[model samples]
Target: MRFMKSFFLTTFNNHLIAYPTPINIHYAWSFGFLSLMCLTLQTVTGIFLAMHYTPHIALAFSSVEHTMRDVNFGWLTRYTHANGASMFFMVAYIHIFRGLYFGSYTKPKQWVWLVGIFIFTLMIMTAFMGYVLPWGQMSLWGATVMTNLVSALPMIGDYMVFWLWGGFSVDNATLNRFFSLHYTLPFVITATSLVHITLTHQEGSGNPLGIDSYSDKVNLYPYFVVKDTYGLFIFTFLFSVFLFFYPNLLGHSDNYVEANPMVTPNHIVPEWYFLPFYAILRSVPHKLWGVIAMLSSIIILSFIPWLHSTETRSSRFRPIYKIFYWTLVFCCLLLGWIGGMPVEEPYITMGQVLSVYYFSYFLTTLPMLGTVENNLMNYFNK
Candidate 1:
């Protein structure tokens, strides 16, 4: 028993306490830790919510209501779980953007980036399924619209849609399946997150300078742990403002109504986190092409490690890349805005233009800009 205890303590110290981290990494580096905290909060609250949630379509909405109104502090539990999803995505996006800015995906850290992308994809799937569990108007229709996109595939599309729905339409089977997967996929995310952290530690953390800091590294304990704790305090304060003050601010008003297939809402929109991709989907007229575009928008990110041509990693060192990177961020925010607007007149045209630029920024701009920067640097040195 003593041997086992000693072994466990030593392993923990090696991985968590004494781990070497780049000395110059900033507070932005804390988002990865924040994301883990969000996941843990979601998982614990989800388990409690599940104890009272019904997977059947007929009772799902009422069960959620019961949990909110009848159960002790159930409202708090539900709100935390719901808002926690938003907080999770917010932190994850910041973490991803920070990685991009510091070129964390370059060289030896590519696997870490790839695993992080996989975790992100899983989060999208899991969040969509969780949205459907409330059995609200937007929830049902959002699931219908997203799952139907699978049918846009050439041959197996319809079959895949059927398999996803478990019937001709989104019904009880679909709810049960989504609930089960929603309950299970978080554990999968947890496992994958371990792999992600392991890979990151193996490659070591990247700093703002985007260079090897092997000689100037510091232990994960004390200094960085205190920094992360400070970040956590700020995060918790903001999270509480939303959780306690305005929980439903992030949710759709239409979702307050129980799902009625016969009476469709005037507009069907997904959660805010999904808006940018949803805009990309709506930009194309053809169903198949639109679906392809939407999927490509995300999948293209995974290829950035190979696409970039310059040896320089940090945007701070690459002036041209820094301009384009911020422009890309603006493009995403614009796409997200266009996504929530009515698909008519100017919105459609704007979405089309933004969508085109979005893909081009990934495929053409990144590689070409990197090449130009490399050429400029060589010319100056020569």
Candidate 2:
């Protein structure tokens, strides 16, 4: 027992206290720590909320209302869990963008990036399941629409959809399955997150300058710990503002109404975080192709470590790459905006065009840009 105690303490100190971090990394690096905090918040609040939640179709909505109105501080728990999801994704997206901009996916850190992407995919699955728990009008229909997309597969599509539904349609069985999975996946994510951090520490953290900082590193304690704490305080303040002042700002009004299978909403939209991929899914004319496009939009990110040919890691040294990076950012924002808009002419056309650019940015532009930058460097040296 004494040996075990010492072993654990030594491990903690090594990873958390004495870990070497790049000295030049700034507030953006803190987002990774912030993401971990969001996950913890979500897990704690989810556990509390689940205690009062009923997964049955007949009582699911009312159970949520009962928890809100009757249980002490239940509204706080529910809102925190709900909005905390958005916070998690917000922090995660920033962390990912920081990785992309600094080229954190390069060389030894490749597995760290890959594991982070896996965590993200799990987050999307968990969030999608959680969204259906309230059994609201939007929740029911959203589940129906999203599950139906599985039928786009060639052979076992219908069977897979049936398995996911656990019935002919979105009903009590579906809710039960989703609730079970939602309650379970966070623990899985937490475990996966440990792997991600372990891999990140194994390779050491990257910096804004995107250069080796092994000889000029600082301990994770004191300096970075203090900086991360400051970031946490600021993040808590903003989170509290949404929690107290505008708890439902990120939610859809249609969700306040109880689900009625007989009635369908005019616009069946998903949460804000999913809008970019949703736009890609809708942009394609065929259902199978649209689903493939939506899935590819995310999967393509995994290929970045291979697709990028430049030896340079940071956008700071690459002027042309920096411009293209921001353009890709704009393209994503436009896709997200287009996702929420009605499926009409100009929106459809716009989405199609941007979707093309989105793939092009990954497949053609990154590789070609690297070649151009390499050529420019060679000519200047001559």
State in Å the error of residue 44, model 1.
Answer: 0.4
lDDT of 2 at 25: 90
lDDT of 1 by residue, 327-381 (tens): 9899999999999999898999999999999999988998899989988998999
lDDT of each structure? 0.94, 0.95
Best by lDDT: 2
Candidate 1: residue 69 lDDT (0-100): 100
- Per-residue alpha-carbon lDDT of candidate 2 for residues 303-369, written as tens digits (9 for 90 to 100): 9999889899999999999999999999999999999999998999999999999999999999999
TM-score of each: 0.98, 0.99
Candidate 2, residue 76: CA error in Å?
0.7
Please list the Cα RMSD from the true structure of every candidate, rounded to 1 decimal place.
1.0, 0.7
RMSD, model 2, all Cα superposed? 0.7
Query: What lDDT would candidate 2 get against the real structure?
Result: 0.95
> What's model 1's TM-score?
0.98
Where in model 2 is the C-alpha error above 4 Å? none
Prediction 2 TM-score vs. true: 0.99
